[model samples]
Target: MEEKLKKIQQDFLNKTKDTKTLAQLDELFIALFGKNGQLDELSKQFKDVPKDELKKVGPLFNQIKQQLEISINEKRGTIRKQIYQSLQNEKFEIPSERTGRKEKKGHLHPVTQFEEDIVKLFEKLGFVQTDAPQIDTDYNNFEVLNIPENHPARDLWDTFYIDTTNYKLQTNKLLLRTHTSNAQIRILKNNKPPIRVMTLGRCFRYENADARHEHTFEQFEIVYVDKDVSMTHLQYLSEYFFKSILGKGIQARLRPKYYPFVEPGVGVDASCAFCKGKGCKVCAGTGWLELAGAGMIHPGVLTRGGIDPDQYSGIAWGVGIERMTMLKYGIEDLRSLKSGDLKFLGRF
Candidate 1:
């Protein structure tokens, strides 16, 4: 057994010296040390050896195994360093052959471009752009917006609430804001009226996405507050904005709609540009495409914002930027806007 072990050790040293590559070293290592390998097969011979020799053979076997492992590791490092130095000394150049394809240039995403255009239009109308946190308190998101605790309207927003105990928010409830209209409450609280401000940002809800709906989406909300702000002003601004996007001669229609924060609310619709109000699939054969929800701010919401509702009136609207972009560009699927497909976005 002693003679056999010495022979195996000499063979290992010779093999290690000749090894020129990591792959070769690895193959040698497995043949000697791996399961069912040379060392493993040799260890089995202990049963056949005389009992008097067993103790000496076992200790020598373990020592050889440990030393071989260290030697192989050091050799591996040396080989790797040599390979790296060779690579560093080598020179390379690009092929001179022409591919004949023009490199593509990147442009703003359709959603981003749409957002910029909307901002420019409102800015022209003297509306200042503003932003609010995506994660917000229940009070700012719901209570201050007239959606009282356990109100049926709360069901309208399938909310995604954050764990307040885990997040340590000041309020017991924290959530991804269901609507950008929460900004209205925050704005009114911090600023004095004769205020014209717009918010364009992302909102979240628990939704099953389809052709027209998404779990997460972008929204644009504008709030205007001053004395004697009437529905006529709302109508005029809505029409002017739609015309700017949809081209001249386009018209807007307003029908009575219910909203928690707005009194005498309206559903704003535009004549479908695709079918010219003659009914089309884009408009779902209705000839009118719903654009936004707008109305006079409810006195309760105004008073909650620190403004005297009796002394002042205001109009507010929340529009889906995706919906407007789809109508303008004749896009059929809402999912495509967020699909992350460069091919689809490159068209815009």
Candidate 2:
């Protein structure tokens, strides 16, 4: 056994000097030092030899195998580095040439961009962000917001109703919330006077799809209730919001309109940003685009929300996110805004 071990070590050393390449060295290593190789078979022979001699030979055999594996791994790493460097320097052109692949970077959807811009603008004006469940009850969605079953404003939102039987506290309904305005009732119930809140989320309507309308759309709404909050406050905020979003040169006008939730309701319009208020195709030659629906909070609406209308005058507005993004970015079709097309979205 002693003579065989000496001979194996001598043979390994002799082979190492003549090894001209890394591959030849690897082949030699497997034959001499690998699991099925001579060094492994010699170590196993210790079990048949005397126990006293086995202990001394076992460690020495393992040490030799470890040293050889370490040396071979180091050479393999050096060889790999050399091959990589050669490939980097050598350029063979023509056949099957590699072309640069274009990478598509993802971005926020345009509706999201519109929502974010509006949130930032309102946040600057002291409105705290708030949210409500997408599925809401009739109380918060309509009744508490001053839209009774018989009221015309309920018509303003084509509601998607849900099963009322599955609920314990329910009598007859649930709905896919039609507007962020529902957050107002929720906000007031959870908060007290001097409440200022804004919310942006999905809203549903049962309208036909067209260049300008969608059955499903995004809505942003703001509610401010405090002592002495009035239409003037509403007007100033509206003007500032449009100017801040559309730029410094924009102008807006308000005309009388009606909603069940707001008395002295107004339809707000902005001078066409694309045409500078001179009649143009974007504005449909109307010189103004309907921008928002806003009004002073009605007495009944305030009373229902656990607030006194006499003591607290308030104003609220709902802006269509689809219209805002489309108008701001010159998007011609409302459908394109939601189309999931890379060509359309990549621009923003």
Candidate 3:
């Protein structure tokens, strides 16, 4: 039994010294120290040995196990050091230092470009550009706009409300403005009539995004307030702006619709340029693409804005900037605008 133990020790030492990698070291450990391995079989044989000899065999087995563990750890460290040194000796070219290729110049985002173009077009029509807060009071966002608490039109906007119990306007709710139309009442409250204001900004809604919709999106609204403002002016403005942005020969029509803030609202639709109003998938086979909502400002809304609706009538229209971008660029998915995909955006 003593001679057999000496043979096992010598064989383990010989195999471990020849191990060149961690994999081989692991295999050696399993063969000698694992369950049902050589060491386990040898330990079992101790039961058959005389009790006086058992003490001598037990100490020798422990000594071999400890030495094997120390040797494996030292070998693993040496292998790691050698591998790291080999990697350090390898040559690699730094990307920024490479020559002969022109650096790509960055450009404005497609949405910003669209906004600028739209602003320019509206400016030419005597509309003054303005902006509004993304976070606004519930009064300006809903109440001031004639959207009462129980009104069904309130359901149209999936609002993101903020806790205002600690705020100065504790009695009022705070929320992400659902539309740029909120700017209309705000502008009217601050400025008197004969206002030709065009506002473009981001709006939010608690909505699931799809090809045509997004929770966060850009909206553009133009509000014109003056005596004798009528549906005729609304139609003319919509057609002119649509033609200016969508290019020549485009036709726009207004179909009767309803909005709480806008009395006798009309749905604005433009003939699909893709199929020339003959009907196609781009227009969902309707031949006319629904564009925006426009109407004379409601008396209740005007009264909330401190304007005399009986003497002064106003026209206002709100359009989705992303929707316009989709039509202008022929993009199928609204998600592409907010995707952060350089390849998709670079096309514009």
Candidate 4:
């Protein structure tokens, strides 16, 4: 088995060397890894190996599979680069005019690019990206985060709920998440203290579409927990994010606000880059544009998350991705980010 594995590995590597186009590479990939393919057939023969040789066979086969996967990925990158470069000098028929010059295939969407930059920024501060269900239980989305039934904060979100009649569950038991804050309770409940995690994804709230708001949007939130956590840490994170993304000249400030999951919540603002902190119409003469909301986690939320409220504290900071991207790129309408206009997307 070991000898056959080594032989197949060598043969496949040689076969891959002969491929050029992505389509060819993809076909080669399936020939070796697909159902009833070389690797798959070999895997089905594991039982035929003697018990004494089985351990050796498993490890060798796994190592060779990993090596092959890595080689194919490297080749895939090379071929993609070649295609992109070659297309630069090639021309194709355009859909409208019936003829046009060659164009680069595509790019990461502006929102995706911006999200990646923010993820990198937070990773430097020991925060790793994590996820929660976009369709989550009301318990996790609201109750666990301390916004219980009839709470004034519940009115803040115009939620879209899932009907449970067919599922035999209670009404409003499951729904599209309104914000990324649903990740906080899961992170806290599942991980030990000194946790630093961020989540970025689609969040929905029923709204009348306009320049300033949308029914569906992206949200980015970070949940931090540990000893000595306080407002100062939250402030530092806000300032660090705005400065790193908006430029070092911009400044951040906090105004007292209210949130059920947090104590002494504050509305976060950054000095208007357009006015350089001087009053302007863009900032509504305030010289500060409201950006995010953050605060030290409330003891009730900490207790609910199974953390000892007396021993540890936390911070929850969240911002709208569209809003941040708009601010950074000087985009006027929130709807434009999702308009799917080639002229707008091509600009990036």
Which numbered prediction scores highest in lDDT against the true structure?
1
For model 3, name the residue pairs that clash. Answer: none
**Residue ranges of candidate 3 with Cα displaced over 4 Å:** 1-100, 165-169, 275-282
Model 4 lowest lDDT segment of ten: 94-103
Candidate 4 C-alpha lDDT tens digits along 1-348: 888999999998987888898999999899999999899999999988898899889989999999998989899999999989999989875574455655568898989999999999999999989999999988888998788799754564588888777776555488889889888888888889999999999999988987668999999999999999998899889988998998887788899998888998999988876677787665778877788989999998889889998999999999988878877887767789999997898887
Query: Model 3: per-residue lDDT, tens digit, 1-348?
Result: 777777888888888788888898888889988999898898888889998887887788788778877877788788888889989999987565477665667888878999999899888878898889999877778887777898754564588888777768655567888989879877888878898899999999888987678999999999999999998899888878898888877788889998878888999988876788898766778888887988999998888888998899998898888878887888877899888998788888
* Models ranked on lDDT: 1, 4, 3, 2
- TM-score each candidate: 0.72, 0.68, 0.68, 0.68
Q: Against the true structure, candidate 4 has what lDDT?
A: 0.87
lDDT, candidates in the order shown? 0.88, 0.81, 0.84, 0.87
Per-residue error for 164 in candidate 4, Å, reads 1.7
Candidate 1 differs from the real structure by a C-alpha RMSD in angstroms, to one decimal, of 5.4
- lDDT per residue as tens, model 1, 1-348: 988887888889788888999999999999999999999999998999998898888898888888788888899999999999999999986544565556678999988898999999999989999999999988889988888789764664588888767665567778899999989888888778899999989999888987678989999999999999999899999988898987886678899998889998999998877788998766788988888999999999999889999889999988999988988887878899989999999999
Window of ten residues with lowest summed lDDT in model 3: 94-103
